[model samples]
Target: MRDLKDIELFLLDMDGTFYLGNKLLPGSIEFVDTLRKQGKNFMFLTNNSSNDSESYAEKLRKMGLDGKIEVFTSGDATGIFLKERYGTLRIFLVGTKKLAKTFEKYGHKIVQEDPEIVVLGYDTEINYEKLAKACIYLRKNLLYVATHPDINCPSLEGPLPDAGSYIALIEKSTGRLPDYIVGKPNPLMLEMVMKKTGVSREKIAMVGDRLYTDIEFARRSGILSILVLTGETTLEDLRNSSIKPDIVVENIGELAKLLQKESGE
Candidate 1:
């Protein structure tokens, strides 16, 4: 196992890794403080696309964390990736109006009538009308893309259905799955992070609570993975899972201590 001291950049998952609902996990603040003191960098990376990056930044700021507009989200990554591949293509966004605005901000053409691509995100306000339209669009052979495939999002209230669940519904109805699922655990997200941060894969570490999404992304992308027990995967889950993280801790608190000890700080 590689040492935490070797990590130069930290990629943090939001919902389960740093905070859930309105509460920050133990040591989340200290983790960031220590990284900043050591001149290391971290970025908040989330698969949820129902909200825009600005919204997340504001949330983090309210939670007493230093956040900026550049914090990455599955929605942002998907929009940027799509724009690069198919510039200004007519896109039918199956997401919140906020997410649609993001695509529009990038100069992509948004059309409900005849779209070239149908991008799905975590639409909390999803309704029958939206689903019906998405079904018809996909049936007509428009390219399908998903922000992420997280089946559930962890909230203080409880786990709620995320974009992946909606994607499943649409796929069942249209007999077609998304052409691409862009977000955590996907190389596209890591690629975008590396590009934005100017960090190499070896210098990056993905920290989260899930093995399937967070750790899988690190494993597949040749980056380090740190699993904290503050969220979804339990120790038993790790034992049974095929994918393994390089380091496992009870929570971010212990992780910060590990870094302090390693650096002799």
Candidate 2:
């Protein structure tokens, strides 16, 4: 196992790992502060494709995390992936207005009629009509893509259905699965991180609360994984699971202390 001190880049999962909903998790700010003080690199990474980066950054700032925050969402990754692979084709995006604007920001044409591809995201504004249109496109055998494969997103209420759940519905409707699911565990997000930060695989660590997306992503991408108990996974879940992280902590607070200790602060 690589030492915590050796991990140069920390890829933070926002929803459960760093913060739950609009509230910052305990020590989230401290963790980032410690990283900064130690001259380590970190970025807020999330699979939520409903909102853009500025929205997340503003949320963090409002939650008392200071500084110029850098955030990358699966929506951003999907846009990049589509742009690089298909060169700004017409897209039928089943997502929120923010997500549509995000696709447009990537230079893709959003068309309700005769789209070249059907893209699925974590559509918070998902409606029957949107799903019906996407299903029709899928039946026509247009290229299908999804932002992330998270079955459920952690919520203050409980685990809520996410893009993966929508995927299942679409599969049942059209008998078609996404041609590509571009998010955690697929290595696409990590590749984007590396491209942006020039960070090597071994030196990066994925820290999150979920075992499947966050830890599995680290496992597949050859990066260290740190699981926190702040959301989703319980100790029993960890013990019975095949997927395991390199490190475990009660919360980001514990991890922050570790980093501070490591830096001799």
Candidate 3:
């Protein structure tokens, strides 16, 4: 409650928080508009590593939001993390062509053979050869890292297999799991967010609908967490879960009104 006044940055989860499927939630635009008008910072923080930031930016543009707004993904985090931790190294990237470009942007050479490390992302363009090579590398005991743990990605038709699903298959084949998963609920993403935004944990808030990823990420990162019952979580679910959010609202629309009142807008 009191923390909202001090928050300089709002790290938002896209799918379930800002919109459900293709439809934008109530006050989705108004909340962001209000934040911009008040000179606060916000970023679309997503775990999807299949698509690059530009793809997400385009998606947002089609959804009636400003495409030029800042967007970050688990792929961005993984690339930055690898660069900072290991400098430039040969990476066996199992992801889309867009994702390969993302790693290249971080100065890492994407190679097919003799990779120093193996990185698994949401590879929408995954093929048997890619999987076979990833499994072979994992079997060789190379450093393994995955983008996120989400097993399924939401789509207009239904839930589609995501990176985590591929992780499971690779694990089964090589009997090895990822050494590190760099995504929500890991707190690594939050550290990257802090480094990029130059915002203190005390001045940041995570707004999302999922208790496990979004709220847990905030709890682990020592930032304020706001849960909106507009996605995967329900009030009953909250009552049953040990992981709790700092604040709960009916929806983003309600939270927007509250923010307006707090700011005397």
Clash totals in order: 0, 0, 0
Per-residue C-alpha lDDT of model 1 across residues 18-75, encoded as one tens digit per residue: 8888888999999988888888888888898888888888988898887443578998
User: Candidate 3, TM-score vs. the true structure?
Assistant: 0.95
Q: Report residue 227 deviation for candidate 3 (angstroms).
A: 1.3
Q: Clash pairs of candidate 1?
A: none
The lDDT of model 2 is: 0.92
- lDDT digits (tens) for residues 1-265 of candidate 3: 4457788899989888898777888889988888877888899899989889988888888889973488889999999998899899899989999999989988999999999999999999999999999888888899999989888887767789998899889978989999999999899999998888889889999999888889999999989999999888899999999999999998887877878888987
Could you give candidate 2's per-residue lDDT for residues 68-180 as a string of tens digits?
69998999888988888889989999998988888888899899999999999999999999999999889998999999999998789998899999999999999999999
Whole-model lDDT per candidate: 0.87, 0.92, 0.89
Which candidate, 2 or 3, would have the higher lDDT against the true structure?
2
| Model 3 score (lDDT) | 0.89
Q: Which residue segments of model 1 deviate by more than 4 Å?
A: 67-70
User: Lowest summed lDDT over 10 consecutive residues: which window, candidate 1?
Assistant: 63-72
What TM-score would each prediction reach against the true structure? 0.96, 0.97, 0.95
RMSD (Å) per prediction: 1.4, 1.0, 1.4
Best by lDDT: 2
